[model samples]
Target: MTETMREVEAGATRELRRYAPLAANDNREDYSLRFAAVSFRRWRPFVVATAALGGIAYLADFAIGASIVLSFGFTSGVLAILAAALVIFLTGIPIAAACARSGVDMDLLTRGAGFGYLGSTLTSLVYGSFTVIFFSLEGAIMAQALEMALHLPLWLGYLVSTLIVLPFAMYGMGAIAKMQTWTQPLWIAGLILPFVVIAVREPGRFAEFASFAGTDGTHGSFSAVGFGFGMGVALSLIGQIGEQADYLRFMPPKTAENKRAWWTAVIAAGPGWVVLGAAKQIGGAFLAFCALGVVGAAHAVEPIAPYVEAVRPALGPMAIALSALFVVISQIKINTTNAYSGSLSFANFFSRVLHRHPGRVWYVLVNCGIALALMEFGAFGFLNKILGFYSNVGIAWIGALVAHLVIVKPLGLAPPYIEFKRAYLPSINPVGFGSMVIASVVSIVAFFGAFGQTAAAFSPLLALVIAMVLVPLFAYLTKGRYYLKRPNTVAGPDVPAALLAGTHECLACGEHYELPDIADCPAHSGAICSLCCTLETTCGTACQEPGAEPVSLGMPTMKLS
Candidate 1:
């Protein structure tokens, strides 16, 4: 035993030295490739909140609303917005609160929320796909504006729009926060200016909008089927909360001095994004209604045409320039977010699956590359079909996640606090994993018309319901045993609270890591960072005693000397 202990110590020392060079520049890395540890989470609450909410100003909401309005008319379109908003708001509250409190990103939150370590990888893929799809959609919108304003070829415009966001997203949260802050005032003014002008100058247009029949011949009446279909399209934005969570993770740790600010930031930047988004959708519907005659039905759903038409009455020939600028600005802001979040998602997914993380920056390029390809493929042309199908999987993922966080955890069917580190979690947790699978399969089938038209239209709702129901059911059936693979043993009353909340030198990497990222490594008989733990697949189960319950490094272990 003494010889074995010596060997472990020597091995740990060598490992630590091996990573010393990388550890020296750790601060510059922004914790992007790994957990956002406490020490690195130094941004102010309001700044992070502003950055998060800024991404919500995307013009895609306008396009989404206009498309629905064109298909379902004003009444059904408005109803769908309201229904989707309610669901998004309610579901988003708990998720946002939990993520903000834990200071973990959506990927980490999903890990502890019932989808175990490897299980959550599936969700990472799903979330990553959402980012790429939206990135392409938003990029395509920008390209449209560029094409209109500069008369650039569509292909060139797409390339320009897609590449412009690379520098902003490359730097991650710090740069993103600054960019969002700088553009917030301009975006808000631009977003509301045309609407205000139209409301005042063309009061009759509002009345005209109310009575306008859609191209689909839906008239200005609500149809249940139409509302259901529209709701599904709107619900696709539910995944936007995941992007929001990515920013919320940067919120400063809550303290008595900033408690109010923290909660405000959490609420405003979290689910509160939907509040602005819902209004934008409704505005888009009205704008599209106004533009129907000028731009015709075919171009009505395009945000550029509607905004240009609205501003033309006021700004005259400059309408094209101003609207193009607005679209470009909006697309840049949202696409940066999409690319950044997608990079994080892909980083998380690939790190676990491949056990190799080149860097977050590398994945940024990968995400943009995929989205660029999607743009070239004309993803924007099939917006409804794409979002409609994607919503099923997205809804299922969020539904299972929220159910675990709000219901299963509260009921003691799972651990209350999020345990994200790979060492403490199983590779798969059926409660969330199985729930997502079942919900996704069923809803996707319904979406593809395996069910009747009404059911097909309401596939996203079905996904949410099914996943929400299954999560609790699975938790109860499994007795929540899979929630944690071991008891947390690295954090407890025995360890100095300050030490747990402060920094520690990782035993394997010789890197200074925040307490949340540090875990006791029994193999090394010292502290190891979560990233090192994840990468050390050859360590075996040396951390646990034979036949003893696996103890997580973050919880109480045998008292340190």
Candidate 2:
């Protein structure tokens, strides 16, 4: 234990070098490497705020909500959505707080939360799946916008929307924060206008909407199988928090002086996003109902189409222009987030699996490339099934992370502050990784036909519960050693003798960070940024500790003190 403590203390402390660009694109040696700098660390509050809002893109949410209504009717769909929001709220708080507190992105946060070093690679895949899948879905929706608004071909419009944002997302926060802020107000008004107009024009639609039969034409009541199925579909939003976390990582450090704003920002941007999401879901339902006469039920369930038809009754030309603008703006806002997070996920993926990174820009291309391919194939067709299936893995990942943040930290089981620096962690921890798998397996089985029909209908809810419970179970069984191979206390607070407390220049990106984010690259034998550390694929995590212990399982008996 003492020996391990000595190593941890030796590496834990670090001092900042001169401010340099963090998360820089390093495409030279790694071919797909990206590194973040500490120089532009502090961002204006509104930038963060708008960027967070960008995830609200794709009005497809309305479609998703309407899908619930079409499939299950109102009562069950609303109930399932409410229940899912509650679960995401409970589950999201810890994960969001951890990311804010640790100053790490989702991938880095996962590593410290319990995923371990390599353990988080799987999470990168899962998290990346959310971003890219949503990217294509939202982009496809954008293509629809162009076709509806400008009579463009679907394939050409898809190509246009996908390539359009490459420039903005390519630059990371520098570009996106501005774009999000500039467009938020317009998008918000455009989204709400249809609802306002519809309220005045069709007073009876809301009341009549409640009794509408399922899209499947089944007369399933509140507890009917169709209702459960609809709710399950709406409940697929279990992982939207991943997008929220991508933006929340940029949250300015909270302080006592700004306590109110800090708390408010965290809540509004974090778990609180569901308020907006729920409203959109309900709005989607209302829009679908109102559009019954114009677009009919077949296309009513489509979010943007309903709004276009709903507003057409109030304003003809304006409705078309507004809907087109809303769709485009929303898709851009949301897709930017998707592209950003996907790039980060791709970075984590290559760094862990291939041990080589080219640059942030390269991964951006990689993720976009995959999304484009999915579009060419029939990704939109499997939207619900894919989301449902992916929700299992997402639930497990969130469950493990939440367990660490809400459970282990609060109970004195894990360290209070997050220890995310690579030098002090083992390659993996089983508590999070193992438990996530268990939760995913159980929930997925239940999602399939393994359980009764009703359970299968709401399998995501089951998955969420099971993942939440299983993560901590595995953590306790592991005795918590797997959480960290080395303790931060080793180097001591205020200052330390060893570790990279002294300044070091990054050999790859030519930036500077603390020893915590900097590691000696064996290939270069020089200090490299954490992003470069990850992008360096040739080393194969050689600097990382052995065994790659499953975070959901347990670490070896070896103690870190």
What's the lDDT for all of these models?
Answer: 0.83, 0.68
Q: In model 1, where do residues sit more than 4 Å from their true spots?
A: 1-13, 17-28, 492-499, 540-561
Candidate 1 per-residue lDDT over residues 369-451, each given as its tens digit: 99999999999889999999999999999999889888887798887677888777888999999999999999999998988
State candidate 2's TM-score: 0.85
Worst 10 residues of 1 by lDDT: 1-10
Cα lDDT tens digits for candidate 2, 178-216: 888888888888887887887898778777877776656
**Model 1: how far residue 97 lies from native, Å:** 0.7
> What TM-score does each of the candidates earn?
0.93, 0.85
TM-score of 1: 0.93
Best by TM-score: 1
Candidate that would win on lDDT: 1
**Residue 154 lDDT, candidate 1, scale 0-100:** 81
